[model samples]
Target: MKKPIKDQKMVIFILLSNVFTAFLGIGLIVPVMPSFKDVMELSGSTMGYLVAVYAVSQLIISPFAGRWVDRFGRKKMIILGLLVFSLSELIFGLGTHVSILYLSRILGGISAAFIMPAVTAYVADITTKEDRPKAMGYVSAAISTGFIIGPGIGGFIADYGIRMPFFFAAIISFLAAISSSLILKESLSHEEREQLSSNTTNFFKDLKKSIQPIYLIAFIMVFVLAFGLSAYETVFSLFSDEKFGFTPKDIASIVTISSIVAVIIQILLFGKLIDKLGEKRMIQLCLIIASVLAFVSTVITGFIAVLIVTCFIFLAFDLLRPALTTFLSKTAGNQQGFVAGMNSTYTSLGNFFGPALGGILFDFNIHYPYLFAGIVLIIGLGLTILWKEKSNEVSL
Candidate 1:
């Protein structure tokens, strides 16, 4: 057998690098989506369709994704996922037809199904329970960094051509794949792999047993949070173009600033804060604050005020993500890959519906989606309030 990892930081750094590249690909297209609609002569609903299709594919594959991560090794799966992601971006860049775009999105979704569960489970495997939150924070910070930086670059390069960002995405993802193959060690032990190979049928039964009430609530919360957040993200460019009279670069700038704030909160604030406040309270607080601010954002049209509110919203978002991830990991027990995959499934459900509805609502009234999202977040706040967790319970 290959030797166990001697340097944990090196392994983690490699994982974070791959995460940054993966999310960068996703964020690269966000700024240029409006341009696609104009050039393709597509309606808002069609735009939403394109966004939702990716998540829909994720939804279909996520149940199996977890098993695959455990069954195959994390290193192999991560590298394969990156390869597929780069190919998908290449397809998106080269294709001119709408159907080809759909195909690209499907491929991207499949790539995500492989990437996220494996990455999260890999984190869980390497870190101690006490250290998990901070490690996850580092991971989240990497993703947020990619998101912020991608748009800043994408918006500018997109001036050359809308497809330029896709080519950039392809190049970056390919590099990420090469890095993973060369540098990252597999997280799963050989004993675990042998056990998995012996119990194909029992894996399903174990998965069924792993779904507990707290986990169910955690799943629901992840879905609702992603749903509400997606409404804002999916239509932000269109809404700003119409209401704020902002160009793509302007929209990109605002998002870049918001994203930078998020990165700080995730890396510097999220772990220590979650350790002190506890996951349940953090979720409730972020939901209510984010909800109120999202509503206030609709009424305050001034760019500076909106940006101020956006900072708070981004902070809320950053805080909630790690909190929920820590909470879900606690509930997952030994089935980290399955639980992470389930988490991705719920998130995919939200992503699928959020954009479709947000787009339709945006066409009816630009302000409606934001208002409705705030209302939906309130429902999540209520759910968190009702949840019960035992004192002194540790995930292990």
Candidate 2:
């Protein structure tokens, strides 16, 4: 029989590793997309479509994955998701056709559907309510670190060849899968798993019952944040190339710098920021700041101006992300995987609309995506205002 596992830190480490691995693979592509488009002879809309398809696939899979993570156990789902993530990156490296890119996105989306909830649920399982925020801080830090660092690293690797980063990302993901399989223990007990199976026999029923107003608002906020950011991503490289005549490496540098700012906020300032602003008020402030920055992006003309705005954007985004997630988790209580999955589902919807809309708008005018995101954020801020008196979550 297996010895009873002891340290919670090990569980937290494994979850952090899984998140870092997933995001690193995703981020590696951000800096290299311009090169890929030139090689593939693709347009802005097609690029946006690629991003949208991934979200669409994830949107379809997330709710099911959320329930399944609760049912099948977190460790198994995370390993499977990581393996698929590796396969998606491998496909991206191997493909000469655009169809392969689409296929890879589909796989990536499916992997996200599984991994997001499983890892989130795993974090909840390993920590007490008092410790959950700090645990989540580590989780957010790992994700943001991978996201910001991955772009610069990918750009550097691309000096060898653009496809090289994809191949390398594949290796990184595969290794994460191996390490997790060897070292990570399942969060759910056998009895809990059995009882979960019997109790959650009706997936739709359980999903319906797990609903709450805070969950709904959390979903909407996730959607809004993703929608606004995806617009910037969909068009940033294109915008830089068109307006400022920036190179791929230059765009990578900007992304890397912005991400560094974000990672710093995620790690160093999360609690202090929340404590100082309060979660409810902070959420409102982030939305307003993001909307303003996103709008400011449309009118800015130079590389340095854009870079400064981008850093602030990342900072606001980082603060907003963990704050909203912590708020949602505090409300989620026991059904961590399912609630987290729903969060992913709403995020996927935003992802879908963001890229698709951004791409469509890009074909018309380059600045439209940024303007569009600003509008979305404004709407989100209005909703946040309405949410003020209702969500009385004073402290976290």
The numbered model that scores best in lDDT is 2
Q: Write the per-residue lDDT of candidate 2 for residues 198-221, one digit (tens) a residue.
A: 765344654464345556666788
Pairs of colliding residues, candidate 2: none
lDDT of each residue in 48-80, candidate 1, tens digit only = 777788889977876677668778878888888
TM-score of each: 0.88, 0.89
What's the number of clashes in each of the models? 0, 0
Candidate maximizing TM-score: 2
TM-score, structure 2 vs. true: 0.89
Candidate 2 local lDDT, residue 234: 63
State the RMSD for candidate 2: 3.5
TM-score of 1: 0.88
